[model samples]
Target: MDADETGRPARQLVVWRPDQVPAQHDVPGPGDLRDGTTTGRLLIRSLMRAQLGLSLMCLAVALTVTASFPVIAAMVPAVGRITVAGLPLTLVVLGFALYPVLFAVGWFYHRQARQLETRFTELVDPPRPEDPAAGRPGPDV
Candidate 1:
C-alpha cells in the first residue's frame, strides 16, 4: 500500500533545548510566610485588611436592604396595602423575597472570599517549574 493509503509517513522528530537558564528572582516563599519576616508580616496584614474590607462591604449591603424595608413602607403607603395570594405584600417580601436577596449577598461574599484566599496561597507557595532535562533522551542516545 502507498504511504498515503496506509496513513503512515516518515518524519523526523525534533527536540528543543533552552540555550540559557532562567533568571532567579527573590520572590517571597512559604518560609517567608511562616517565619513572619517583615515582608511576610506585611503580606499577612494586607490580606487581613482585604478580608475586613470585604466583610464590611457585605455587612453594609445587608444592613441597607434590611433597614430600607420599613422606610419604604412608611414612605409609600400603597406598597403596604398591596396583597398577593391573600398575603400582604410586605409580608410576602419579608417572608420570601428578602431570603433570595440575602442568599445572593452571602453567595457573592463566599465566592469573593475564596478567590482572595486562593490568590494569597499562590503568592506564598508557587508551583515549581518542571526540570528542563527531565523525560528527555540523554546525549548518549
Candidate 2:
C-alpha cells in the first residue's frame, strides 16, 4: 500500500493465482499437452480418434436398430398394425423411425470426417518462402 497524494492509503494490486497457460491447439483442448503447444501429430491424432469414436457410436446404434427389425416385423401381423405419431406402422418402424435415427448418427460421423480432413489440409499446405524478396537470407552474407 502507498499513500495517495491526498493522503488516502492506496491498495497494492494482488495476484493470487499465476497466469493461465495459453492453449496448446487452436482446436478445443486436451489441455496444453506440453508447454502449451499443440503439434500437428497431436492434432491429426485427436481428430482421427474423435471421428472414430463417433463412427463406433453410430455403428452401435445401427446394429441395435437392425437387430430389432425382425421382432418388430413379427408383431405387425399379430397386432394387425401399430401407427406411431401419425405415420404408418410399417413405415414408421422400419423406414422412418429406425433408419432416420441411424442416418442422423451416420451424418454426425460424416461431419466429423469432413472437419478432420479440412484441418489436415491446413496442416499440410502452408505458405512457403522461396522468392528472394520473400525474406531469404541474401547470398551476400
Candidate 3:
C-alpha cells in the first residue's frame, strides 16, 4: 500500500495559509459582553419584549377559547342540549374543537419562537464568509 513520509497511509493534511489564519479582532473579547453597549442592550430588550408578547398572545387565545365554553353553557343552557351526530354539541366542541385550537396555539407559538431565535442569532453572530479551504487539502506544511 502507498505510504506517506511518516510511513502512514497517504491521507490529506490541512495546511492553513496566512490569510486563513483568523484575525484577533474577529474574536469577541470579555469587554464586548461587559461593556453593555446600546446595541447590545437594545437586542436584549427586543428579545425580552418579543418573548413576552408571544406568551401573552398565546395565553389570551387559550383563555378566550377555554372560558367561552362555561360562559356559553351558563348563558344559554339550550346550547348544551344541542346534538351533532348523536353527540352533545358541547361534548363535540369541547373534546374536538378545543384540540384544534390548542394545536393551532402551539403551532403559532413554535413558529414565532423559532423566528425570534433566528433573528437573535443573526443579530448576535453575524454570518462569516465560507472558508475556501474547508474540507480540502492546502499547501504542504
Clashes of each: 0, 0, 0
TM-score for each of the candidates:
0.67, 0.39, 0.64
In what order do the candidates fall by TM-score, top score first? 1, 3, 2
Residue-by-residue lDDT tens digits, candidate 3, 36-95: 555545557778999999989998999898888899899999988999999999789877
Give the winner by TM-score: 2 or 3. Answer: 3
Give the best candidate by TM-score: 1
Q: Across residues 21-132, which tens digit of lDDT does each residue of candidate 1 receive? A: 2222367655555666777677889999999999999999998998899999999999899999999998899889989989889989988887787788767654434554
Q: Once model 3 is optimally superposed onto the true structure by TM-score, how far is the C-alpha of residue 74 displaced, in angstroms?
A: 0.4
TM-score for candidate 3, residues paired by index = 0.64
lDDT of 2 by residue, 10-84 (tens): 877654221243443555332333344556456657767877777787788788777876776786675436667
lDDT of 2: 0.59
| Inter-residue clash pairs, candidate 3 | none
True-vs-predicted CA distance for residue 46, candidate 1, Å: 1.0
